[model samples]
Target: MTKPNLLPRSSDMASETSAEFSWPPLESNPEVFTEYLYQLGLPSDWFVGEVFGLDDDSLGFVPRPAVAVIVTFESLKKETDAVAAAKVDFFMKQSPKLDYACGVIACIHSVLNSLDSITLVENSILEKYYRATKTQSPADRATTLENMTEFQEVHTSYASLGQSSVPTAEDDVKHHFVTFVQNALGQLIELDGLKKGPVVVNAASSDILKDTAAVIQARIEAGVYSDSLAVLTLAKVADDIDAAVQALIDSSNGVLEVTSVENKDGAKVSRIKCTATGHEMPPRADIVTAHVNSKRFKKATEWYSYDFAQFEPYIVSHRRKPKCLFCNVTGIVLNKIPSEVEKHMQGRKFVRMKEHVKFFDEAEIDKDD
Candidate 1:
C-alpha cells in the first residue's frame, strides 16, 4: 500500500543533485542482511534469511507468514515505454516510494511498507530516515539519503560485506534490488526505487511469500533477468534469544548468573554459572533443560568432592572450562567428575604421563605467556 513512510512527492521539488553519489552493491546474502539490519534497529526477534528457491517447495522452507520477499535482479536500461508497458489496475488507482543503494532502497522499501510486521527501532538511523522523508519526493529522498551521514555510514559499512570485489563510487553496479510486500489490503505490491510508482504484483493474496514466489516465477519465465536471481525473505526466526536468556536468568532464583569476562583470546564471553554450587557452564537452555529433567546431578557433588578430589592436582580450568590436566595434555574434552577421571586414568596415555611425571597445565601456560 502507499504509505507516507517514504518521501511525499511534490510538483516543484528539485530533483537535481549538485554532486553525484553511488552506494556499493550488496551481496544477496541472508546472513549479511540479517546482521546489517540488526545493526540498524531491526528487532532481535526478526531476521532475514535466504529463500532457497521460488518454487512452492523452496518457498515452503521459509518461516511461515513471511512478511516480505526481496529479489536481486538485473536493473535493465529504462525502456521508453517501460512505465506504460503491461500496466494493470486494481479497484482503485496508484500512489507511492532510490539509489546503488538499490539494495538499501529495497531494504527500506520492504521494511517501511511492511510496518505491520516490522517496527523500526525508536531513534534508530532507519527511523530517523523514515521520519525525515515521509513527506519528500523520491528525488528529494535520494538527496536526503546522500547527505545523511550516519545512515550513509551504516550502508557503506555493510556494502563491503558483499562477497565480490567492493565496487567503487565510480563503478557501475549491475545487481539491483526490489521488494514485494503486501499492503494493508493484502494486495501484493512491488516497490522499486527505479519504478514510476508502486506496481501491484497481484490483486489479492492469502500468503505473501507464496504469492511473491508466483510473481517471481512468472518473471523468470518471461526472461526478465539475464542472470540467475537471488531471493531473500524477512521473517520471525525465533524468540529473541537474548530475551529468552534474560528470562531464564530472572527465573533462575539465584542459582544461575551470567557474567561477561574476557577470555585468554580477549573476546568477551558470557559465562554461565550455578552460583549456589560454584559451578560454571555454557549459557544454553538445553543444558538447563537436561539438568532439571534428569537425575544426572543428584550425585554430581559427591562425584566431584568425594570420589574425584584425589585428582585435584590433575584438574585445571582452561578457557573457562574445567578440564582434566591429563586430557588437555593429551588433547580432548569435555568436563570434570570422578567417574570420568577414573575412566581416563586407566588409559595407557594417563599411565605414561603419571609414570614419568609428565604433566601439563594450559592455564599456567596462558598465565606465563
Candidate 2:
C-alpha cells in the first residue's frame, strides 16, 4: 500500500521536485477498509490533495496547498463550518477530481451496505422499523398503521424471536443502533447512485463468509454439496485455526514430544529431548548406578568412556601439545593419582628413586651368585 505523501517538499537548489503525487495504499480487504473509514471519524464527503512550498520556518504549520476534501450535506455557508463539515480533510488544499471523489464515496457505500446486512441478521425487527422510519415519508395515523402492522409481522415471528436472544439489553440496543446506521447508509447509497461499482468488503470482518463456510461444511457432511468447495473453505479456516494454535504454542514455548517407559522391575522413567542441544536423556538422572558389583564396574567403565568421548572433540581441536605437570616433561602419561602412575605431570618435581634402584641392584646380584 502506498503511504500518504504529506511530508513537506525539500527546497534544495540542486534538486528538482515533481508536481504529481501518489495515492495512499488502498485497503484490499473490504472488512478492514470499512473499519479504517469509520476510524477516520466518518467523513460526510472524502477529499485528497497535494501540498507545496513547505519550509523549516513554518514547522508544525498546516499548509494551504495540502489536499483537503470534504463530504458533507451541509452547505459551505461559513469558512469555519465548511472546513469542519466533514471529518476527513487531507492536508493539501488542492481539490481532488470528481472521479476520485465518486470512487471513494462508492467504496465507503459498499462497506456501509455490508455492515447493514450484518445488522439485519443481528436484529430484524429493529432494522425493519429503522428502515421504515428513514425511507418512508412522514404520514398520518392510517399510513403508519400499515407500517406498524408490517413491522409487527416481521418482528413477532418465532424465527425472529429465536434470532433476537441477544444475551443482554445493551446488546439489543447496540444492535438497534447499528441497524439504524445501516438503514441510513442504504438511503445514502441509493441517493448517490453508488450501487453499480465493485463493492469490496474487508475479509477480516466477513461474518457472512464465515457463515457460508459453516453451511458449506454442513452440506458436505450431509452429502449435498461437493467436497471441493467445502474443502477449500475448510482450508482457509484451517489457516486461521493454525494461527490460533501457533499462538498457544508460542505462549507455552513450543510443543514437547515426550516419551514414558516402565521397566520390568516396576520402575517408571521419562525422557525428553532438548531443543537446543538435540540430546535425549532421562529427566531425573544425570548418571545412574546399579547395586551389583559387576554392574558397578561396567557402569564405571561406561562412565569413563562417555566422559572421554565428550572431551575427545575438544582434545583434538586444541592447538597446543599436552605436557606432564610434575617433571615439566612432554609425552608423559596423564593420571589423577600419582601413586598408581609412573610418569609425573609438568610443573612439579619427580620422586627420588635412587635408593630404591640401589637396593634392587644388590638383591639382583645376590640372586645371580
Candidate 3:
C-alpha cells in the first residue's frame, strides 16, 4: 500500500481574505526562530540565538561571525515609523492583508540578505519563494508571499509552540520586528517590511552586529519597546564544526588514539599511546566497572558511536566499550570490544541506519511533548 501523504493540503488549512488574513504573533525566543529558519531552508549549521544585551560583556556572548540580527520592540504608535527610506538594497513590503506577520517577514529579510553565506536546501519552501519573488516588484512580492500556503502552514505550526497564551487573529498587537543586514555594498541596513525601503544604519559598518546593538540600545534609551524589547541573532553555529569535533578527540589526553587494538576472547584491549608523550598508557582495569551505564546511555544504538562526538547521536562510548541502543532494545549481543566496532561502523547496514536513528532520536527528544 502507498504511504499516506505527510504534507498538509491547502484545503486542510484555514483560508483567509484580505480582511481576515491574520496570523497569531510568533514568539521572539531563540528556539522558535531557529526552527523557523531551519524549516524555511536555513541549514542545520546556522541557528538563531538570543543577543542578551548591548553591554560589552553581554554582546561578548554573541556567537562570532553572526550574519543577521532581528530585534523586537513594542511600538506605541499605530502606524509605521515616518523615516524616509533610501537606496533599496533588499526590501519586500509586507502586504496589508498579512496581519501579525512582521516577525516572519523580518526573518525572511534575514535569510535573503545572508544568501552570500547560505546554501539553501534544494527547492525548500523558502528557496522556491525566493526565486518566485526575486524579480517581482515590492508590491507583487508581498502579494506572492501573502498567497503562499506552505509558508502559512509552517508559520501556524510553530506559532502555537509559543510559551505565552495564543492570541486570536483579531487581537490587536503593537509588537513589531525588524532585521539588520549587511548589503552587498558593505553598508549595514535595516529591513522593515513596514518601511518603504531599506534604511541605511551605517554606510561603512566595520561590524554590523555592534552597530545594530548601538541602534537598538538607542531605541531603548528613547523609550521604544520599553519592557517588551528583545534581540535575536541568526549566527553561524560554528566556523568549523567538524574541525572542532576533531580537536575534541585530539585533546582527549591521549586516551582515544591506539597504536594497535587486539581482541582477547570477548574483550578488546588497546595499547593506548599518548600522542603528547612518546610513551604508552595501557588500558588498565582500575576499580571502575564501566565509564557508562545502560541507563546513562540514551535508549538508542549506533555502529560508529565510538568514532567521535560527531557520531554521538548514532553511538556512544562507555569507558572503551562502544554501546549501541539498538543492541539494548533488540537484545542483540553488543559489540564487546574496540576491534569489533570498526567493521560494524563501516558496514552498509550501520551507515544506512543514520536516518532510522535520527527519526528514533528525535522521537526520544520530543517524548516530553
RMSD of each: 11.9, 29.3, 17.5
lDDT of 1 at 241: 33
**Model 3: which residue pairs collide?**
300-325, 301-324, 301-325, 301-326, 305-315
lDDT of 1 by residue, 301-339 (tens): 344344444564554444555533345444555366666
lDDT of 3: 0.65
lDDT string for model 2 (1-369, tens) is: 999643221221112211221112121222233223323322312112111112233211211211111122211121111111111111111123111222233332333334322233223332333333333332221133222433223222311222324232222121000000112212211113212212212222223323323433454566644432201100000111223223332442332223555533355545443332233333211111111123533443333333332222212222242221222223234432333223331233323432232223577889999
lDDT of 3 at 288: 9
Candidates ranked by lDDT, best first? 3, 1, 2
Give the per-residue lDDT digits (tens) of candidate 3, residues 1-369.
Answer: 999855433343335642245567888877788777778888766778777668876676566678899988887544445654555434688776766788888888888888888888877888877877777777777777777777877887888775667677667676889999887777888898877788877887888778998887776666654656888888875433233334433655433454554432233444444332233433321100111112322122222233444434444444443342223222234443444544667767676654365335667779967
TM match of model 2 to true structure: 0.17
Stronger candidate by TM-score (2 vs 3): 3
Candidate 3 residue-wise lDDT at 357: 52
Instruction: Give the TM-score comparing model 1 with the true structure, all chains together.
Output: 0.57
How many clashes in candidate 2?
A: 25
Better of 1 and 3 by lDDT: 3
TM-score of 3: 0.59
